[model samples]
Target: MEDQVELKRVFGDVYFRARRDQNTSIVYAHWYGSQAVETVKAGGYKFLEMIKEKPYRKLLNSNEHVIGSWDLALEWAQNEWAPQMRKAGLRYLAYVVPTTIYASMTMEMLIQRIDDEFEIRNKEADAEAWLLR
Candidate 1:
């Protein structure tokens, strides 16, 4: 499998990438970064939808997977992307990256809110294990 990681800033959302199989793409947002959290808070669903509809859509056709960084964002992602993507035969997986000690607790909280949330099988390891599968 061919993999690529790119750092991109879209509408002020600074995120990193971990792409596997070209079609299967994951956008790992920088959680502790200066602008990103604020950008998401400010942009809300509008920003997420734009990201989903444009950049994510380009990579994710039928039978592709797109992963995002935050659970709140994932909630937005599920509501915004899942139905359309599923109809097209694509799957969406949303998992949180524990960038800080605080974020690990945050992930736990978010996991409680959603049913059947995708948790990293091994929180201590890299996401590649889960993403590649």
Candidate 2:
């Protein structure tokens, strides 16, 4: 994050924090733990609102520390968030999948179903590289 500029961290009901990297014009969200779909949506909507503060085109979302099944969020992610984000000028998304098996499966399914542009990576550095590239 050496070259990155920060937006004040935003928190939500779910275990996650979001900030903007002005250098890359990307919204970076780090999600943790298992959460109810409603809580997840709360955080997701917060993320969407953050991007609206600026015309960012890329997102680097890391699920590396996640352990809970968020399978329920898949539908909203694909149907609601993806479409809304695309309409908001988001052109690229670099999703860092969780290392834990169950969470990874859910996230993989989510990335698979999302209609908008996305590139999945195993690590944040890889995701950043992909986003920056």
Candidate 3:
């Protein structure tokens, strides 16, 4: 199937895009500023809504551009979002880790708690390769 850009949602400092290609759906996130709890929750809602509409086994989540720690958001994601997303047919999530130590740490923590296949890479290309594989 041809790649189609499905849901594109922006809330505060975060931008979410879901694009479908064949059996894969890439969920891209470009975030600015600190990821507040409300903004993170809104973004998570949009993400879940889009993924449920089109079940995708593969996902690429780019977070390299995020500048600050989203520790609280990470907790919410691990406890709330991850389980729901996994149930929505998300099998593998390839993530491009952020540059800051705190952001990276939070991402690591979230990754550890999730049951689905999760990979963290330093580059977007690497993340995409993992997702495609």
Best by lDDT: 2
> In candidate 2, which residue pairs clash?
none
The C-alpha local distance difference test score for the whole of candidate 1 amounts to 0.39
What TM-score does candidate 3 get on C-alpha atoms? 0.75
Model 1 agreement with the true structure over 84-116: per-residue lDDT tens digits: 444443333445445455445545554454424
* Candidate 1 TM-score over all chains jointly: 0.41
Better of 1 and 3 by TM-score: 3
Can you give the TM-score per candidate against the true fold?
Answer: 0.41, 0.82, 0.75
Ranking by TM-score: 2, 3, 1
What residue pairs are clashing in model 1?
Answer: none
Model with the higher TM-score, candidate 1 or 2: 2
After aligning candidate 2 to the native by TM-score, how far in Å is the CA of 61 from where it should be? 0.2
lDDT of 2 by residue, 33-100 (tens): 77568757877787777766676888888888788788888889888998888788787888788888
Instruction: Sum up the clashes in candidate 1.
Output: 0
> What tens digits encode model 3's per-residue C-alpha lDDT throughout 16-67?
4445665445655455445667767776776677678867776676666666
